[model samples]
Target: MIIGIDPGQSGGIAGIDGDASYAVPMPLIGKDIDGHKIAAQLKSLTPDVVIIEKVHAMPKQGVSSTFKFGMGFGIVIGVCEALGIPYRLVTPQAWKKAVLAGTTKDKDAAIAFVRRAYPSIDLTPGRKRVPHDGMADAVCLAEYGRQIMGNISEVS
Candidate 1:
């Protein structure tokens, strides 16, 4: 299994195979919260590898949000490390282009492309759409990792 994470001020986790998937939006925890909560959730999924959305320095308008996101990301990394699960960090543009090939430079267009590509997935319909962006992005990362690994036997 591949576990993909879209870190936010409030983080999200998604587990995916070619056809199977699960997503959850997790509340942000202060430094006081037990890191084991994340580890436990991930452990329950039995992920073989982890894909983390790389943290970047966003524009000033997003500075505070990005900072909190980074903290959450660190927790994710630590959990993955402790579990000895190998991980890779993928940039937003890289992940977006990989999943939204031939459709870049426009965020809305990329989102639309993902929705169109994975029509069977509940990525952008009704109230589910609210969490779709982050969840879909994580799914994209998982799919990308599967593609790179070049085999579905394990995923299946």
Candidate 2:
């Protein structure tokens, strides 16, 4: 199994086990708090690999976002490393392009593409029936990981 995470002010987790995909939106937390959540999730899944979103610091945005993202990412990395699960960090652009391709750059467009890709999966946002951007992004990362691994198998 492989899990892909899209990290941000709010983060998302997507898991691909065999041919199935599952995703959920999660609150971003401090290192101490997030470590517990990561452990719980990892314990449930027991994934063979964990793919986390690479933190890309934007210019002029101060250090707060970077720090938060980095802290969140660190907890995830630590969990994966300790469990001996291989991990990969993919860039936002790479995941977006892989999922959206020629679609618009808007979040809604990306969500639509995700819905189309995983029509059977339920990724609705919030308590309401809206699409979750974070979850959708995570799904994209999962699918992208699938594609990459599929290509690698073909090459080998």
Candidate 3:
């Protein structure tokens, strides 16, 4: 299985195994990441490799928020390392360019792309009206990894 993570409170993690895929929002406790929960998920997934979205603080973000975001990102990396899972970082631009292609580089575009790409999966959870853009991006990131990795058995 290949895992992809979008690190932030609003972000999500996705696991893709062949034609199957699963996603969940980043686990959080208050403003901090729930590392234990994340670790549990990673353990269960037993990913062969992980793909994390390379992110940085935005120009206009507050210091406190930026620090919190950084902390979450760190937790993700730490969990992957603790599990001994190989991982790669892909920038939002690069993944979008590869997976999203001709579509607009925006949340809505990603959502639409996933809707078309994975029609079997339910992007919208609970009773919410809209699809989760974070989940969509996570899936796209996984797709990007899968595309680059090609056939895993042939990689060696």
Best by TM-score: 3
Off by over 4 Å in 1: 30-34, 61-66, 105-110, 117-120, 123-131, 151-156
lDDT of 1 by residue, 42-97 (tens): 87888878888887666765876666657677878898899888888887776666
C-alpha TM-scores of all predictions = 0.75, 0.82, 0.92
Clashes of 3: 0
Structure candidate 1, residue pairs in collision: none
At residue 38, what lDDT does model 1 achieve? Answer: 73
What clash pairs does model 2 have?
none
Worst 10 residues of 3 by lDDT: 147-156
Q: How would you order the candidates by TM-score, starting with the best?
A: 3, 2, 1
lDDT of 3 at 25: 75
- Tens digit per residue, CA lDDT, model 3, 1-156: 988888888888888898998887778888678989989998988888888898899999999999988988998999988888888887898889888888888999888887888776667777767888888888888888888886443221
Ranking by lDDT: 3, 2, 1
**Candidate 2 per-residue lDDT over residues 100-151, each given as its tens digit:** 7888856887689777877776777557577778777777777777778755
lDDT of 3: 0.84
* RMSD in angstroms between candidate 1 and the native structure over all alpha carbons: 4.7
TM-score of candidate 2 to 2 decimals: 0.82
CA shift of 76, model 3, Å: 0.3
